[model samples]
Target chain A: MAARERDGLKAVPYRSAYRRVAWFVVGALLVLGPVVFTPYWLGLLTQVMVFAVLAMSLDILLGYTGLPSLGHAGLFGVAAYAVAVLSTAHHASFWVCVIGGIVAGTLVSAVFGLFVSHVRDVYFLMITLALGMVVWGLSYRWIPVTGGDNGISGIPRLESHAGLPVSGPTPVYYVTLAVLIVCGVLMARLVRSPFGYTLRGIRENEARMKSLGFNTWLHCYVSYVIAGAFASVAGVLWAYYNGFVGPTYVDLTASSEVFLMVTLGGPGTLVGPALGAGAIVLLKNVMSAYTHRWLLILGAVYIVTILGAPQGLWNLRVSSPPRGTRRTRR
Target chain B: MSWWRVALVVVIAGATLVATAQPVSPPIKLGFLAPLSGAYAQNGRDILNGLLLYLDEIGYRAAGRTIELLVEDDEAIPAVGLTKARKLVERDGVHVMAGALLSSTGYALAPYIDSMRIPMVYPVVSADDLTQRKRSKWIVRTGYSGSQPNHAFGEYAYRVLKLRKVATIALDYAFGWESVGGFERTFVADGGAVTQKIWCPVSVHDFAPYLTQVSRDVDAVYALVLGRAALQFMRQYREFGLKDRVLLIGAGTTTDEHVLPFMGDEALGVITALHYSAALDTPANRTFVAAYRARFRKIPSYYAESMYTGAKWLVAATESIHGHVEDRAALVDALRAVKVADLPRGPVELDAYGNPIENVYVRKVERVNGELQNTVIATFPKVSQFWKYNPSDYLKQPLYSR
Candidate 1:
């Protein structure tokens, strides 16, 4: 017991040192990635960052609260459409468009959460799928408003209210990077807070949480809306980046892709989803240039990842226990 | 010193020598975006084959420079299309682009092409706005607009066929809406009434309920359906015995040459109008058809013809400019100025909108040597995209939307 306590004490400084090194490396990459990457790769990295935000939002719902949403794209696409319509039609300022997208996404999610909050498991999945399809139908069939299958195009690049030009690929990538960092920090804080603990408790034992006087449904509802709002942030950036929005963005295929990213990354891990997004987007954009069967390669990677490391690539390492854990337990 | 350092030094020296030795002109890279692996893969293949066939005939050289073609599959999604297009421009550094089979993809790409200042030659996306309301100087469409052939068909149905009452059925989308709109405008102006108009969803598998609503009082029915849907509609129309009761007319793609041979007798006697027909008895068309057949082991469709024409136009423009596409504006001007007196589709000229002004042939599906063919019976010469309507006036009207 004394030897185990000594071993535990020895692990503390080493673990903290490891963490500091990891963070330092991450900071260095974040600062220098744009400089190192070519313009084309920068564009791709920007897309990866945008999708990372989206996958992280999905992770918050499915991984934390165990909601298993299939209509995440509906929120994302609605926000994009809102931004597109306001900016194109009303000529709203950039801040106004961004807020409008977030509000629209939040409101839609609130209403949808009200409807589906009572359902659980497969029923919830089906409802979300149906909701996604309805949004897609609206975008596709409402030709006058949504521009039908052609979608809304020619959205001007984002500019500050003061008319400072924040356009072009480089400026846009930096803007997206800033937003991603802010969202990542906020989400990490949210998932570690007391409210986050309650969510995990509910996920593990809903009845037990209910017995403990927790309003599980309200918690789920709030998480759902929060996830939707985060997705909208990604959508707003995407709309500004692509300068276009179409029904394809809201379709079931897009929602399924986010779910794939969440699962392929370690679910419930903040950075895992971002890594997954990077891997998937890179595999698609980079590998596609060299070969036509990139999808096949992606599929092979997915199968290998699933079979070899079921907890995802992020959790593959075997680690020593942290210092003081054995001492505290004893 | 290490062997690797010596190897790196030799490689740098070799690169410097090659850079200084520049003899031949650099190759002009042309990017081709198409749906190579999705629902529209077959159509994409046909278009690519047509473009490549022309290049092959020229021995892959134009304007004293080797022409390099880069193909990317967009999977028929607009977002994917835009991403691939950007990759081609920013990464591959392609000077020009061609081939967008889906209208949605084409529409999404219009602004990007303008922003990048690269010219694009559209082969088979027939969105009218690309050449009309939202026309861009950077774009030149070698393919027909959605409304072009329908306008001619409307006139022919009213004048030659002597149809006073016509009903229309089409897929409920931009292409369908524009087609019927063009037909309605022309038919109404010619003192003919359209009895009924039916729009079915693009993914609709059953056309029974819609077919039942087609009024028997109409003198003829004009339908605009594409791909497998066209085949399904034709077979169902035959099964319902409506073919014997009323004259059936359609947009050119309803009985498109690509689908006709496979359709057997189901498409017999169906009349339509289009810019190109393989059976167009002319020296240029005969030679094109022969070469296409010899190369691809099949008769060329309008898609193949459109891409072939686009390739020919690109070659002509490149030759005129002595392969100097470095000046984008000059290249665009050169492209606009060149007029083809003889193409597989006959004489073609670009209107102010950069859309083709070419002959529209009114053809019928007939069996020739036990194989189905679109046999041209009437020709509307030198038809513009706007048909007889004044361009300015047409642009004043709101775009056709359902």
Candidate 2:
């Protein structure tokens, strides 16, 4: 098996050096973005980065594992509410709130994962959607804890370990950028690892992988949990950035938006989801300023993208390459 | 001539042109943010049309400055509203902001507007906190707060209707809670007991279950439903045979004029309270109704009236300061100081909290010439947002939703 994998890797040379250089340049520009743009743009870019993290997490399950989830925002929203409630109600520290949010999100997703991992196709989608609706209902109906539709407001900014004010746009942007880069690198490695390969094999042919002594359901459950944990991180960042959390953040519209970002960017690619998030967020904010028919324009763009670039906007260039031509050497 | 000599000559010519150019004062950019494309689009468009109509009536010039309106859609979402509001202030550099259609959006943008030091006039969003506990100096609510009409309705329900016992069937949200709380406070204080409080979900399609749960012993039912939900609840209430059994009263939005035309005879004789009514017999309201109907081809709802009043108030304040909106603090002060004695909705003045102290009309949904109308039955004069309670006392209490 190892020899066959080595031969597969040998079919394509590694492009690590080129990829590293590209990342370094991207990182530099992201760091300098705050200084170059106005505060408004900085705030918007910060939101884009936060949502990019969320989109990438959704990509992990939908792209890699072939697990379509409509409840991704459920995990994200629960974590946000956890952080919001803890920070506002219990006055928890930033690190404690972050940990609490991630743990809460993971726990909820684990339970949901356990229940839905065995299901396939539309059933999985339906179950996940139902779960998402349940979370939305809780947030909307639980007046005492979630503040109902008005939501929990007056959330304080993130306090650093040194107790410095790290809640401003520049600091938040840098923090989000650093987290996004680290998460992107880790996620890339995860998808390339042996375990990640197993998940992909399962995605391609679950029966073949299962017959080869693989626990496909276990793999999917773990992947779902991990994806949910990452989504929670984005949720915490969002809650703090917006200084508020409401049911709308976790509603069906938000979940569908995450799915749209993942699919629109090229589901399987790490950078695709982020790019997709950036495109959609920028479109909504920028186009909305010019015309009231922005939603119509957005729908038109989606239709055009689907028709012109079936693989995705980001995959336009890569479509020309043979399927295995771009494979990297192990 | 050499290239450098020709360049120098052109530079001199450009400098001379610059020096002789008249300094044109930039237009006063007034930003209007509302949900122009989402659930409340109709209400939003009506508000915008009302504002634009006033601008058109005044020839778009206010106090020697051309009033340039910068409109943006908030999509009725808080986050979107905040983003659009920021764009309006930061990118377009609007001198004044106005026209928010949702309470949540208003609540989200209020603190941001205060931080930016931009004076904002709210037309329709009526979260009570914007005027009470969370009041900002830079914000003036030209529209009614959630509690304003409800407070008056409570009085009317107790005094005029002579109801000793009532029940509330309100939408389960901040606005609903505020409306119910205001009614409960006043009704209970006026020697009336609330028999039951039933909260239905905002998106409930069938309100029959909730309607059946409403106590039959109550003298009146105070409802706080809005939009299609209101339509559904009213239809169901009548279908369940409860409408005739009990006195149905509510906030004016329950039988909004915009929806009344389509509500048929189902909404007739329904009593509600609000700050504005198109059926107001005053000369000012008569003129406003005529102009609005002639322009929009529809009777103006309270939202339109509020925004029209808001625009008129801004114009009056701008005229008072001779169009100097550059000084936001002075403009806000002028806005707060100017009292409208004969506006479309009658006399209105800004209270200390910058919320309007106006007459809340107790209106009845009556049919006149086969057209549904909110006919003013009684008026609660000089009602403040705090109702009869002291300002500080009201602030000590948490928000109704909380």
Candidate 3:
């Protein structure tokens, strides 16, 4: 499982070009998603897009770098609730509310990331797991603001930017698409940059990066904050789309959902999680709608999907191999 | 295109084909915001059924205009419920809404009612703020008033049935707190000694931890929780042999049709206090019972009864204004003046505060005709919102003492 790379199909190195073409097609479809689906169906797809963003962001920490801090949902949930509280309670503009959510998710993750980046494997995971639980507990008990187990609701919608005539599903879909595109592009550029190499160096052997006289913690911490920012954007979309946020968003279960998404589409492929999220969310919605035994079916599907395609649903055969063994190419 | 590209395009085209089959509606559809797809799905489903029954019976016409309903499942999460409501009102253009079977959603959707001004006629949100002094006009209850069931239980237990001591175990929420709070006010005011109270959160799946927590000295244990959570609590309550030891009784939220069908022998012989017992001997009730049985192949719950009643009364109120609901003030006046002696719940009438003041029935759970339900034992006529003891004085504090 660890050996596969260059699109996780070690036999097919030129598959990177195929991956680019696949992404282009997916991007076009994403833009046309609203026209293709009704408000309800579009709403479900919007959730898929949101989680896709989350899973991609998580890829930075778990894939690009080996810091598998388990409490990513803490940032996600706080961002969601922060948007709700800020917009409804403080009457901040939607964009301001969103920035507030991003800042919150980043700062919260950064402080904890600073502390946890110093630790290795199990300790980092345990600290994050603990922090996630703490956030969940606070949200549950803090009835006045978080609305307790009830959650905060009735958040206002963000209107069109620059008089683009944004009012309904089409606008929200476009906005979400724009956010995902920008973040995806930014992540792609960041991963291909020298900083990306440093993060990969840390992942391969933090000892080597340190021996090279580089502060490895800074890279990991910086990537963690970036992931946190991306996650908070997803959170903002969730808050607006759902028009609410609760303690459950920050709970261990939510953290597990991210883990599931990532595992179903893991190991350094940026856009793989988006497909993974799409598969999981679509299967979940359709299966739940059809049968009473939906949870069982979902569990079975997750296991089957995981076992069948160890490299995730995206890495199934699409193209032939490159000529050379490997080349870190342009 | 290559085989892989063909497969990809086929997949996308398949998704598009699936998406286009469902038809969207006009009429600013009233969304039935409910937890219709989870454990509490039955209750939410029934509530939506009640709404649908109203829509069908009246030909989808309300106040001389066509009305369409769009139902969204909240799955009983406050966040999900809130999201569903906002989507219904904002994006879906639902004029009004109701449901989300959990009390947590009551508070979640409250601000949205104000935000939209679409006037959600809550099917079963008995939260105090919903009908208390801080009540919103946009939020009308076509269901049981929160404090009434508790006040009824307490009054019947202490004043009429002459029970001396009472204890309570309830979900910790506005519903549980208000239910028991209403009871404590009545029981304590009527020279009754209230022995104990237990407040459990919604997630406590097991009740054994708190079953023995109630003292054996109390006359009866008032069970206030409901749904699968309530079912689990009751099964364990009886399994521990405490049901026979201390008589289990409360506002009958669990003992009613919404949950009674779900609880077989576990709920046998439990006394409950409620406004609508499935056994209420009335022509309107019999019609309701028969129609509900025929439509859903199940007995109607008190929640269903109240919803049906609300619909019937809403129609009646509209007719009183001669179907000219074009005047908002007049419609409200008509709603306030509603009095139906022949409704399913027995002599339903709204007081000055728009809360229903109806007769209370004391029912003992006995399997009649192979189904567990509340059988009427006693009746109290014209029970008011302010019980023998006013909760405004008592509900001020968070918790009550011995």
Please report the candidate that would top TM-score against the real structure.
1
Tens-place lDDT per residue, model 1, A1-330, is: 111212113445776678668878876776787788777888898899999999999988877777788999999999999998988878888788889999998899999889878777788889999998999999999887789989998877764432665556777878888999899887877877888777777776789999999999999989988999999999998898888899889999999988888878766667768888988888988788889898899899999988876655654533432221111110
Q: Which ten residues in a row have the lowest lDDT in candidate 3 chain A?
A: A321-330
lDDT of 3: 0.73
Top-down TM-score ranking: 1, 2, 3
User: Best by DockQ, which number?
Assistant: 1
Give each model's whole-structure lDDT.
Answer: 0.86, 0.84, 0.73
Q: DockQ score for model 1, please?
A: 0.59
Every model's TM-score: 0.93, 0.91, 0.76
Task: Give the per-residue lDDT of model 2 (tens digit) for A1-330.
Answer: 111221123332345456556667776778898778887898789888888989999988887788889989999999999998998889888788889988999899989998889887778889999999999999988978987777777677654422665544678778888888788777777777888788778777799999999999899999999999899889888887777788888989999999889878767677778889999999999887777788899999889987886566665644363242222210
Q: Is the docking of candidate 3 incorrect, acceptable, medium or high quality?
A: acceptable
Instruction: Write one digit per residue (lDDT tens) for candidate 1, span B1-402.
Output: 999999999999999999889867789999999988877787888899999999999999998899999999998889999999999999999988899988889988998899889999998999999999899889999998998988888888899999999999999988999888888888889999988989998887989999999988899999998878888999999888898998899988898877887797878999998998999999999999999999999999898999999999998998899899877888888889987657899999999898999999999999999989999999999999989889999899987766
Clashes of each: 0, 0, 1
- Measured with C-alpha atoms, the lDDT of residue A47 in candidate 3 is 79
Cα displacement (angstroms), candidate 2, residue B325, comes to 2.5
Which whole-number lDDT from 0 to 100 does residue B361 have in model 3? 86
Task: Please give, for residues A65-160, the per-residue lDDT of candidate 3 as tens digits.
Answer: 776767888888889989989987888875688789888887888887777777766787798889888888888877777767666766775553
Error of 1 at A189 (Å): 1.2
RMSD of each: 5.7, 4.5, 9.7
Q: Score residue B97 of candidate 3 by CA lDDT.
A: 59
Compare candidates 1 and 2 on DockQ and give the better one: 1
Candidate 2 clashes between residue pairs 3 or more apart in a chain or in different chains: none
